[model samples]
Target: MNVRFEKLYEETKAAVMRYVSAHCYSITDIDDLFQDTYLAVYKSMQSLTEPIQSSEAYVIGVAKKVLARHYSAVRRLRAQIDVSLDRRSGRGLAEETADSVDVEKLAGDRELLDEIFELVTVMPVTVQRAFYMHYVLEMSFAEVGNELDLSEAAVRQRVARALTEIRRLYKRREQL
Candidate 1:
């Protein structure tokens, strides 16, 4: 809309897209992350201080935070699903103990393996959507906000909260 915003968009869009792509795996995910990043930038443009010379740096910082949050939430949900599956399988106590240990080990491996999609589906609708846009789709925070009608900061916060929940889930799994 404004000249400054337009200029900012043109100058940083590719960098932002690359940033998102580095964190994601798919073309669709890349597009989503790119959009989210820009949408976040758009919403926060008004609050930025003057002489903000490094737009790319700031946007990348935001993108990192967003990616961390998304991954965290997905990890948490995965932990929960693993736990639930463990319970439903109704293995004996000794078997359960062995299974639990195996599951914890599995979780660690899953994290390394980047089996995120399996866990991403368990989040709440809004969270999942945001998660998909930012992580799976690789949309930037701003892009996520624009598609979902939220602020970039709000998207960042959502992803962060999701990560927190996920960490809690993993900790619980490890303890069990």
Candidate 2:
């Protein structure tokens, strides 16, 4: 700590703390942010091309930058977490649609399960792969997409369509 720079830091530290406290909503982040702001200020202070007129004002600028970076990172992490959750939950689209179909019937009737499996085998190749990977193998839509070289949306659509087709076929059989 240069004696001149140390003097300036002492003068501005309180004002910088207040500025950081004012901008931040979370108490847990405040101390860490306060530390980061001063670390930046110290680095800037080291590169003294010319003396700053108002050291307090200069430190406040550094604190603002730190706060901006913190919030930007927090936003990015939040978005990634949201996207991950949406993708996983979206994988259940077929299951939700299948819920409309009577799975309990298949559970009690082995012959009906066999018939449904046959119907699934005769479905379009894309639909069959999507349905089998997702339902039979219990794979997530994203995993099915990777296995079938399709997008997650495409995989979800195929599985859903397969379920719809099976329902139609099962109803036709019931009528007969």
Worst 10 residues of 1 by lDDT: 90-99
Query: What digit string (tens of lDDT, one per residue) describes model 1 on residues 51-134?
Result: 557978988877776666555777546534332453323222222222223444656566533433444444455566778667
- Cα lDDT of model 2 by residue, 21-122, tens digit: 445534335578889987887887778788889888888888888888888976647634222333223233332233355556556766667666656555
Best by lDDT: 2
Given candidate 2, what's the lDDT at residue 100?
Answer: 52
lDDT of candidate model 2 versus the reference: 0.65
* Per-residue error (Å), model 2, residue 86: 23
Choose the strongest candidate by TM-score. 2
What ranges in model 1 sit over 4 Å off? 74-176
Lowest-lDDT window of 10 residues in candidate 2?
A: 81-90
TM-score of model 2 vs. true structure? 0.42
